[model samples]
Target: MSLKYAVLAALLEGEASGYELSKVFDVSLANFWPATPQQLYRELERLAGDGLIEARTVPQERRPTKRMFSLTAAGREQLAAFAAEPTRRPTAVRDEFLIKMQAMDGVDPRAVRALVEERRAWALGKLARYERVRERLLDGRTEEEYLRDADRVGPYLTLLAGITFERDNARWCERVLTVLGERRAAAGPAGPAALG
Candidate 1:
């Protein structure tokens, strides 16, 4: 998704300065969209120039003035149009490591396993973070609460997807480990897997 739409979606919650929008992007939109602070700031400028967002300088007592941003009518209209459009099919992962794994006969299996292990760990960490955020949001609420407040409901779905994805990655790692173990047991002398 475009940063423009992401910024507009974040501002839909409320008006925010660039710094606040950065935090909002991390906390709220991170599951579906991710952008660095630099990218957010640049997009804010573009949106303001396009008249899609209104910006006003907020004077501060002892600090530099911050430019606060909020969606204008055009911005809201854009978001509405975007929301109404049909979503395309999901894209596949474009990782170069997958290509390397497919041609792994020429490479070291251990190195590929290490890469997979690293990715699994990273995915697990993100899954843990999403779980924490979901717990915080859900609190002790029931399904009724979610049904009532539909605007704040994207996290749980994305969290579930991420958790399942990481869990599958962990399973994949276990299967790979088993295959590697068998290969190691059979090939004793050179241990070609150790090349990595």
Candidate 2:
């Protein structure tokens, strides 16, 4: 998906300055669509130029004017059309960590183990953050009530997917660590190379 659609979808929450939108992307959309602040700013400009979003200049007392953006009708229609399009491409996993794992047998297993542990820790951290986001979204309501009565469920549902992805990642990392530990024990003294 393009950053255009991501920015447009974000504006659905309400009008926001580019800075505010960047924060929203960092917190809420990072799981699915990661963008640097520069990238977001560039996309915002493009979207504005394309007439998909309208920018309002807000004067500040002590600072330079800031531009806040809101989705134009065209933006909404564009997002809707993008959403309606059937996803023809399969999801792809293009992680450098996976490449490192694949080459583990050719390198030091200890190093690879450390990297996997780091990934597991990151996944756990993200899972915790997503849980907090979920709680905030639910706002004291039960999941059923939130899902049934919330004006918008897209954010909540996407957050759920992020939570699940992180949870599964942590679990997979745990299994990998266990298997590596077992193999190390079976190989004895000289490390993984000894198994060969």
Candidate 3:
């Protein structure tokens, strides 16, 4: 999906300045749709020109004025239309790590292990953050209760997806590390060459 749709969906919660929206993207939308601050700012300008979003400048005493943005009526209609469209199957992931894995025969096992370990740490950190966000969404309620009673389910559902993806990533990384560690151990002081 385009960044425009992501911006519109974020505005559904309420009006926010570009900075606030950037934070929103980082915290919530980063899971599925990532955007840089510059990209978001440019999109905001285009959205305003297209009349999909309206912006009002807020005067500040000691700082540059900030423009707060809200979705226009047309924006809501556009978002609704987009939502009604048929979903497309996600394309296969294209990642550098996958390429490295495929070329592992020519690469150093220690290097591969290091990369995988870093990824594992990152995935674990992201999973922990996602869990905290999930808890916040759930508040004091159970999952079923939250699902039934929350004002909007979209964010929670997306958070669940992020959680699942990170969990799987962590598991895959752990498995890779285990296999590499065993290979290294079996190869002894001569290293991978000994195994070959």
Candidate 4:
């Protein structure tokens, strides 16, 4: 999907400045549709130009004026039509880390293990961040309450997918580390060459 749709969907939350939208993308959409602040700002301008969104300049007492954006009726219609489209491309995995893992046999096992360990830590950190977001989204409500009564549940559902993905990633990394450790142990003091 284009960044246009992502911006439109984010505006569904309500009116926000470009800076605010960047933060929203970082906390929420970073998992699936990562965008730099510059990209978002440019998309916002394009969206406004296309009449898909409306922007109003808001004056501040002590700061420069900022433009707040909201989805126009046309933007909503566009988003709805895009959502109704029947076909979507399947997700493809294109990770550099996976490529390195594939070439692990030719590299130092110690180096590969360090990379895997780093990945696991990163995944765990993401999982923790996602959990915090989930809590904040839920507020004081239980999961059942939030899911049943919240006006928008798409964010919550997507957050769940992200949590699951990170959990699975961390688990897979642990398993890989275990297997590599075993192989290294078997290879003994002679090092990775002994494995051959």
Better of 1 and 3 by lDDT: 3
Q: List the residue pairs that clash in candidate 1.
A: none
Clashes found in each candidate (C-alpha, N, C closer than 3 A): 0, 0, 0, 0
How accurate locally, in lDDT, is each candidate? 0.77, 0.89, 0.88, 0.90
Candidate 2 lDDT, 15-102, residue by residue in tens? 9999998888887798888788899889999999999999999999998889999999999999999989997667666789988888
The residue pairs that clash in candidate 4, if any, are none
- Candidate 3: worst-modelled 10 consecutive residues by lDDT: 86-95
Residues 157-195 of candidate 4 have per-residue lDDT tens digits of: 999999999999999999999999898888886766733
Please, what are the lDDT tens digits per residue for candidate 3 over residues 33-152?
888899899999999999999999999999999999999999999999998988665634657877878877767887788889898898899899889888988988999999998899
lDDT of 2 at 61: 95
Question: All candidates' TM-scores?
Answer: 0.76, 0.91, 0.90, 0.91
The regions of model 2 sitting more than 4 angstroms off are 62-64, 194-196
Candidate 1 regions off by >4 Å? 23-30, 59-64, 88-92, 143-151, 188-196
Error of 1 at 31 (Å): 3.9
TM-score of the candidate numbered 2? 0.91
Answer with 3 or 4, whichever has the higher TM-score: 4
Q: Tell me the spans in candidate 4 whose CA falls farther than 4 Å from its real position.
A: 194-196
TM-score of model 1 (CA atoms): 0.76
Give per-residue CA lDDT, model 1, range 9-96, as digits (tens).
7788778999987886675466567778999999999999999999999999999899999999999999989878887647456657
C-alpha-based local distance difference test score of model 2? 0.89
